[model samples]
Target: MGAKERYILLLIIDSLIVTFSVFIGYYILAPFFLQYTMPVLITTSIILLISHHVFAYVFNLYHRAWEYASVRELMSIAQAVTASIITTYILNILLFQTTFTRLMIITWMMHLILIGGSRLSWRVARHHLIGKQSSDQEKLRTLIVGAGKGGSILIKQMLDTPAMNMLPVVAVDDDSTKQRMELAGGVRVEGKREDIEKLIKKYDIRKVVIAIPSLSKTELNEIYELSNHESVEVMIMPNIDDVMSGKVEVNALKKVEVEDLLGREPVKLDTAGIEEQVRDRTILVTGAGGSIGSEIVRQITKFQPREIVLLGHGENSIYTILEEMTGRNNNIEYIPIIADVQDRQRMFEVFETYKPNIVYHAAAHKHVPLMEYNPKEAVKNNIIGTKNTAEAACEYKTEKFVLISTDKAVNPPNVMGASKRVAEMVVQGLNQNCKETTLVAVRFGNVLGSRGSVIPKFRKQIEAGGPITVTDERMTRYFMTIPEASRLVIQAGAIAEGGEVFVLDMGEPVKIVNLARNMIKLSGYKEDEIGIKFSGVRPGEKLFEELLSEDEIHPNQVYTKIYRGKTVSYPIIEIEKTIKQLENNNNIKELLLDFVNRKEYTKN
Candidate 1:
């Protein structure tokens, strides 16, 4: 009903109940108090009616959603009724010089019951009639995996929101005490986690939602595996806090992704230390539009930097990141420079103008096979571009300079890896002489959901209804989320002294073929439905990528998931000479690889 109609209807009902309550109370006590006549009763009715509505409006009793009424709503009605009764008692003593004590007590009881019943009946009627009709519709039989507070809330929401078309049939909890216990909407916890497969068969369940927000990755993976039936789809509930706070709806369950099954806990950052180093500092990030660069920008903003210089070759990307940063925070100044890092003059001018306290040089050509095909382009961007930016940082006396290196740079076989290694050497070489700027490198493996990453490629192939290609069955690479990688980069800066290559502990290496299979399953397809194709490994691709070389391993973690490698000392002159050769050398790829791998370039 419309708000006006609901208000008027409730008002009429309350007025009638208020008038009848006083009259009935007077008549019931009339035998004892024979002196009180119809005139006195009529006077009491008028007083009760006005006082009830005034208190009702004060308590906002008329504006509540009675269809969703609970104890809280009933309590509001009680308070309003009691206040009105007290007002009527006081007015009776003043005007009639006599008060009906028994009548007032009886009237209060009747008024409370009638008002509360009128509101609570809406909830009872809606729950039975509307909920039953919704359940009768064609809905997926859902199985909830947790029977705690999160599970209870989810079940109630599912029952209340029939338009979602997910009928929660049963729930499962590992806790023995909760087994066979009924939760909201009469959905009982049928069995333990081990009984998931059996329950699916027993209930013919089509959907399973893991409702435990604090479930560990290992436990979540186990639950997902058990619920991985051909016709069944597994999903996860959003965080319980988010749901309760109205940030997201309970019905907004997300599909399980391979990233969730990685079984690695996120690394906790030293927030206090990071903030001390980053807060109010003028920070500069090259390649600020790319995946890792953009995430670093986002993470840095948390510390409330005074100003951020976003330098990138792509105008569109720079504009995009600039727009996003400005929308979120207006206090910090964001300067976007659409200039390539390879432009020495432009890089120098930017540094001189901003004189940033810290620099994150993320600009680079990172694709492996693509870099191999056009080694010159990789040399220009990755090698020379890094040199130009690092040199500018040194000249500008920047406090700290962080190089976003890659795992491929260790024991490298690809042009991209070799180029990044050369870029690292440039910073290491410069850090030797540049006392003002602390230059360090943070190395990590492939980040999930980055541009041109395997996950997005597999998703597109699955959407196209065909085979998802795996480069090789044996290919394995370390994986971390973009935010994790970026956060570690910032953390590395907090601990950086100089010339140290900080390797991130990218937990375990995952096989490429297995990752592809997981993606297909997560997309609600069987193995046969989306066939796997084993294309031979591409050029510059390795069977496995290493985070640190044997000689470079520090054997101790400097921080959580962050290790500082043994600094490799490279002669600044030779490093510059090799970069100069990239201008006209025909065998640029061969020369770049030779320079990075040669032991002679390192000092005794």
Candidate 2:
């Protein structure tokens, strides 16, 4: 309706209500009171009609759309009605020197009901009568998981806005108390989560919307696994806090991705302690362009450091990170240094120039097969580079040095893993000898979306509509997200005293084939649609990755989900001699393999 028409209609309806309420009130009270004669009652009714219309105009009741009325609108209605009757009572006394107190009270009560109910009835009629017709004809039946505040909000939105394309049919919650409870728009918490499949069949549900935003990753995976039994589409709601804060709308739901299933619970850290160490301190991060190193840079920026020195071998990757950090954190200082970790002299030069208070050594040759082919580069980058950085840290009296080690370093089979194992020894040895600098190593498994991780490879293959390659059906690896890994790395530095090798608790080892299958499904394809190829394991690749070797005992929990791996006594001079011998040896690959095998052999 047009604005003029709506205003006119509301004005006329309110006038009739006021007139009727006053007339009925006077009729009932006329027989009891002789002062309230028929003429006097008629005159009083006329005065009330005029006074009510004046108050309603002053309160702007006609300007509002009653169909969308809420508490604020109802309060306005009460105010206008009260003001009209109060004004009538005063005027009747002033003119006739008499008052009909009982008559006015009855009229006031009647005015409230007739006016408030009329406005509320429009919303009720639309939701129950009109909305049900549209929902039944056009909307898809949606089953909502989680019958909490988030689910209630989603149900109201769906009912109020049919253009959202789905109507909530039923809700499921794990809390038994909530069962048999009804939510907004008549959506009921019919049963528990285990009954989801049955409810889907019973209601002929086409879509399932998970409305719990605060669900832990572990619980989310369990719920999704159960919900995926049917061929219906599944969507997940974004964080409720974000929605409430207006960062996103309540209807902003997205398809559950592969990362959601494989991810673990978010790691909580001591931000105050981290800030005390990093704030106002000059920090240097080697390999600042690589996946893990770059994320470390980003995470450290949150600590508000005095300066962040981005030292990397590649100019382009370094430039990319520098640009991103510049745009995101313009208040902090970022110094981009293009230098390789293998250059011992250059490493000392960068350390002396920056004089960084804390150092995060992340540069290393991490590709297993490629490092297996080129063992010399692995030794140069992983072992010697670590030695140079560790020794430089000690010389410059850097407060703490954190080396990023991997799970492959445990019972090492590949040159890359062996190199990292020796690097850990280098850091521990330096920490043992030097009292000024506290050196520690953090060991974790493959990060989910790192530069050369299998996640991106599987995604590419799925996007190309071809066979997705898996090394072996039985091969398994522990996975953590990049942010989680980087946070734990910083946590290690926070918890380190000296010479401690920290191991992160990677929840479970996921089978490689299962990872591939999930990626295919997330990409909107079935197993048969995208063929799975069993590519034989590559050289230096293990059937399963280990977080810690058998001899490395975890004697302490430094923080939750983080443990301290006991440092083995290895002579610093012996480790130095091995590095020198590696440079001169013609059979470098054999020596590297033996170096790692001897460590495991000693463990036995």
Candidate 3:
């Protein structure tokens, strides 16, 4: 309605309510009190009508849209009702001396009911009238896998938001107490999880929205495996803390991506340990623009570092990391230095200038096939970059130099892996000679959505409306989310002493075919229709990638989940000669073969 029309409607309604209340008060009390008459009561009624209108303005009564009225609206109603009651009491006490108890009680009840109900009535009406109509036509029949606070709030929000177009038909929860119980919005909690298939068919549910955001990876994977059943697309609500903290917006309610389905149980780390390492310290993240480097950059900032240097080779990467760091944390000092790590002079300059107490060397060429094709570049970047960074750390008297190595470095068949093996050797070899700096390496598997990862390639293909290609059906690789991998790297750094080849226990390897299949399904395509083309495995692509070799394993007493691998050690003379040959000559192929065949650059 227009402003004029709304104001006129409000005035008319307030006038009628005020008049009716006074009239009723006078009628019942006239016989019992100082001979009250219609004219006196009529005068009082007119005054109250004006007074109540003023009260309504004070409460922002006309300002509020009743569709959103709740406890807050009711609170305002109480305040306004109190104001009207005081005004009425004064009028009857001073002029008529007719304070009829029963009459006043009736007025009080009527005033609250009539005034408060008016504001809330429209909202109740909207749900019943508008909601019923919309649900019949526009609702997406959905099932809730978790019948908890997160689920209930999501359901309420859906019901309140008419545009959501989602109607939760059933709630599936494992909590026995919630079973067969009706929630606030009359949503009934069904029995335990075994009833998923039954509930899906019973409700004819088209979609499933999981409300357990804080669930451990194990719990999430279990749920995903169950929901992998046909025809029921799944989604996840933001976790409890996410909703409360406002990190996950209401619109962030979304379908389950591959990560959510493949995730493992949550790992509760010693935050105290992490904070102890990061707080009040200057941290240098090498390759800060890359996936893992950026994540460590993110995670470390949360602990409020003294300063963080975003050291990377690529100019664009430096800018991107600087941009991200600036957006997330402005309080901490972040310097983006773009310099190739292969240059000893450049690395030395960075170390002498920044003087960072802790250095995280994440700079490396990680792509397997790409590195295989460009072995020379890989050696120069990965092996040489790592050596320069480590030596500079030692020279600068840095406390810890953590190298971000990969599982590929262990018994590696590819050039990328072989170079990383040499890189690990450089770090550990430095640790042996240098006592001031503790050089360590954290080895883990592929990170999903990293640069040149299969996930991004599949997404791009899907967006272009074409056949999504997979290297091989039987090919399998362990995976972790980008941020998760980075966090683990930081955690590994915090936990490292010296020459500790810490390997994160990546839960299980996922088959490449299955990953492709899930991505296809998520894009709303059937297998046969939007065909998945099995492109033959590229050069250096293995059928199955192993985290470690059979012989290079040992139990660590400190952290059971992390194991230390046995690495072949080279004589200082041999190491120096190999590095000199690599730097002097561009023939990385000869060095890689000799290093791999002799296992001279093997795991530690």
User: Highest TM-score among the candidates is held by which one?
Assistant: 1
TM-score of 3: 0.91
All candidates in order of TM-score, best leading? 1, 3, 2
> Model 3 segments beyond 4 Å from truth?
2-4, 29-35, 90-101, 128-138, 183-187, 240-252, 328-330, 584-587, 597-604
Q: What are the runs in model 2 whose C-alpha is more than 4 Å off?
A: 1-138, 301-304, 314-332, 373-376, 522-524, 580-587, 599-604
1-604 per-residue lDDT for model 3 (tens digits): 6767767776787678878886776666666655556686676777677778888889887777777687888888778767876786787678777664565567777878887777677788877987667756857788887878788778877788767777878888999988998765777888677787777778888777888877776677677666665666778887678787888765467777887666555455667888887888899989889888888888888788899999888899889879877886458988989888889899999999988889988888888888878987888898888888899999989989999888887777788888887887777777888898888888899888888888888888888776888878788999988777777777777778788777888878899888888887776666776678888988777788777677667755345346666644555556667877876776776677577557434454
TM-score per candidate, chains pooled: 0.95, 0.82, 0.91
Candidate models: Cα lDDT each: 0.90, 0.87, 0.79
Worst 10 residues of 2 by lDDT: 595-604
Model 3's alpha-carbon lDDT is 0.79
* Candidate 1 lDDT score relative to the true structure: 0.90
Error of 1 at 464 (Å): 2.1
Candidate 1 per-residue lDDT over residues 1-604, each given as its tens digit:
8999989999999999999988887778777777677898898999999999999999999899888787788889999999999999999999999867889999999988888888888788888898667755788999999999899988887887778789899999999999889988789999999999999999999999999978888899999999988889999999999988999988889998998887377788999999998899999999999999999999999998999999888999999999999999559999999899889999999999999999998998889989889999999999999999999999999999999999999989889999999999888999999999999999999999999899899999999996998888899988899988999999999999999999999988999888888888899999899999998999989998898888887899999999889987898998878778877898987887787778765542
Clashes of each: 0, 0, 7
Name the TM-score of candidate 1.
0.95
Candidate 2 lDDT (Cα, 0 to 1): 0.87
- In candidate 1, what residue range of length 10 has the lowest lDDT sum? 595-604
Better model by TM-score: candidate 1 vs candidate 3: 1
